[model samples]
Target: MLKRVLLLLLSLMLITTLLVGCGGGTTEPETPEETPEATQPEAEETAAIKMAMVTDVGGVNDQSFNQSAWEGHQKARNELGVEVNYVESNQDADYLPNLEQLYDAGYDLIWGIGFMMGDVILEAAEQNPDQKYAIIDNAYGDTPSNLVGVLFKAEEASFLVGYIAGKMTETGKVGFVGGMDFPVIHGFHYGFMAGVKHANPDVEVLVQYAGDFNDAAIGKAIAIQMYQSGADIVFHAAGGTGDGVIEAAREQGKYAIGVDRDQNDLAPDNVITSAMKRVDNAIFNIAEELKAGNFPGGGTVVYGLEDGGVGIAPTSDKHVPADILEETRAIEQQIIRGEIFVPDNEADYNANY
Candidate 1:
C-alpha cells in the first residue's frame, strides 16, 4: 500500500510539470505579437505639417495672383507631404479674420496673396510673432521677424509688352487700363509707357484706371472707349476686370496685352503678349525655405528680370514681327544688366515722361 501511494504522488508531480511547460510555450508567441504593437505607436506619431493661404478679394481662380500662389502651395504639399488649405476673402474685412483662422488652426505658413493685404498682414504679424507669414506684391514698413514680403519687378516685363504694343499698333494711339491706383499697378503703367517710348517716342498712350479690381463692367467701358478713340492695342493690369479688356479687344478686332499669367489663350487671335509675373516661382521658393527650416524674415525679397521672376510671354501663333521681337529681347537683356531702371513710384513716372 505505501509503494502504490508513492507511485501516485510521482504521477501527480509529472502532470504539474507538463502543465507549466505548455503555458510558457503559449506566452512566447504573445511576446512577439506585442513587439509589433509597440512600433505602431511610433508610426502614428509621424504626421504631415500643415500650410495655408488666404487669397485677396479676387479669390483663388482669378487666373492671376491668387491662382499662381495657390498652385505653389499645392506643389509644396505634394512634394513635401504637407497638408494644405486656402481661404478666399471676398471682402476686404475678411483679410485679418481669414489669416487669424489659419493661424489658430496651427498652420505653419500663411500666405497673404496681394498688396491689399499689407495693412492687415502687418497688424496680424505683430500680434502673432510666433507664427510665420508671407505677403506677396507688397512689404510692410514694420514687418516682424517671422514675416516675409515678396515684391516683384513687374515693370521689366511690362516694358517688354509695351514695346510689342508700340510696334504692333496700326494706330499710333495705345491705351493702359489698371485695376487700382496702387504703386504695384503703377509699376506696370510706368514700365509699359517707358517701353512704348523706347520703341516709338511719338506714340500716345491713353491711361485709365478701372478703380476696382473686381469690376468687369468698368473695365469693358474703359477698354471700349480706348478702342473707339483710335487705340489699336490696350494693355490691362486689372484683375477680373482685365477679362473685359480681352473681350473688348476680341470684339473690336484690336490687340490687348494680358497680365500675370499666359493670357494669350484668353483671346488667341487678339492677344499680342502678356506681361508675365512668376508668382508661382516666388511662392514655391518661400514654401521650400519654410520646409527646410529657413524662413526669410523681416525683409523684402525682390524678384526681378534677372531672377526669372518677370518676363514677357512667348509670341503666340498669331506671330509678332521678327524685328519687333528682336528689339524687345535686346531691351530685356539691358534691364537684366541694370542698364535700364524701370520705375515703381509715381515720381519716376512723372520724371521719365
Candidate 2:
C-alpha cells in the first residue's frame, strides 16, 4: 500500500513539471504591438504643350519686334507651363528650312515673326494642312483653316510720334531710315512724313532705305549723312539696323524715333520715344489662346489704335514737354476718331494730301 501511494505522488509531480515547461506556469498573455502604415508613391506631373517660333532673317534678338514676340512666347513658357522654342534665320533662304524642321518635330503650334516670312509660312501652312500657325506683321489672302494673321496699324502709331518729332525739332528737319522700301516699311515712312507735315508743313523730311534690315553699319552711315544734311531727329524702321540709327543719334547728340516696340530705353538720351506695335501683346494673345484650346484662327485679325494694338511708347528720360505729350494723346484720339486720316502708303498720302 505505501509503494502504490509513492508511485501516485511521483506521477503527479512529473505531470506538473511537463505543464510548466510547456509555458503554463504563468496565466498572463504577452502584450500586442501596432503595425505602421505603408507609404504611398507620388503622382507624376502632366506634360506641357509644345510650340515653336521661327524668326525671320531679322533674327530673334533684333531688339525690335522680333525680340518682343520672343518675350511674349517666353512668358507663356515660364508662367503658363507651355514649351516654346525659336530658330533664327541667318538669311532669307533659311526661312523655309527652319520652319519645316520645327513642323516635322511635332510642335503643337508654330509662329513666324516678320512680314518677310509671309510667303514661307504660307507655303508651310499649305503643306502641313493640319498644323496651327500664328504670323506677325503679315496678312495673307486665301486664308488657311489653321492660320491666323496678326497685323498691326503701325502707320497710325508712327504718325503720332512723327508729330512729336516735328514739334520738337530744333532744325525744322527730320529723317527716316528704312530697312526696305516694302509696303510695310513704306507705310511707316509715309505716315511719319504726313504727321511731320501736319505739324510743321514747312519741315523737311528726308528718307533713305538701308536695302537690308540686318546691316547696322549701313544704317549708321545713312543716318550720319541725314544728320549732316541738317536733320535733328531720325526715325528708323530698319530692324536690327535701327540699332545703328540710335547709335548715330547718340554720336550726333540728336534724338531718334524707334519702331516696332517701345525703344526709348535703347538709348535714353537719344531716343525720344518709340512707335509701339504691341508685338509682345499679339504673341502672348496667340499663345494664351492656343493654351486655352481657343485657336484664334482663319483670316486676319487687325490690331490698331482702337484695339490697343498700336501706340507711342511712354517718353522715358526724354523729358518730353507736357504740351507735346498732351498733343500726342490728342493726335492719337484724332486718328481713332477719323479726324486724322493717316495714310498707309504713297497712294493714300497722295489722295489725302
- What residue runs in model 1 are displaced by over 4 Å at the alpha carbon? 1-47, 315-318
> At residue 9, what lDDT does model 2 achieve?
100
| Candidate 2 RMSD to the correct structure | 4.8
lDDT of 1: 0.88
Model 1: per-residue lDDT, tens digit, 166-241?
Answer: 8888789999999999889999999999888888988899999999998878888999999999999999999989
lDDT (Cα atoms) of all candidates against the true structure: 0.88, 0.88
Count clashing residue pairs in model 1: 0
Model 1 poorest 10 in a row by lDDT: 30-39
So what's the TM-score on candidate 2?
A: 0.86
The TM-score values for the models, in the order shown, are 0.86, 0.86
- Decoy 1 TM-score against native: 0.86
Q: Which stretches of model 2 miss by more than 4 angstroms?
A: 1-46
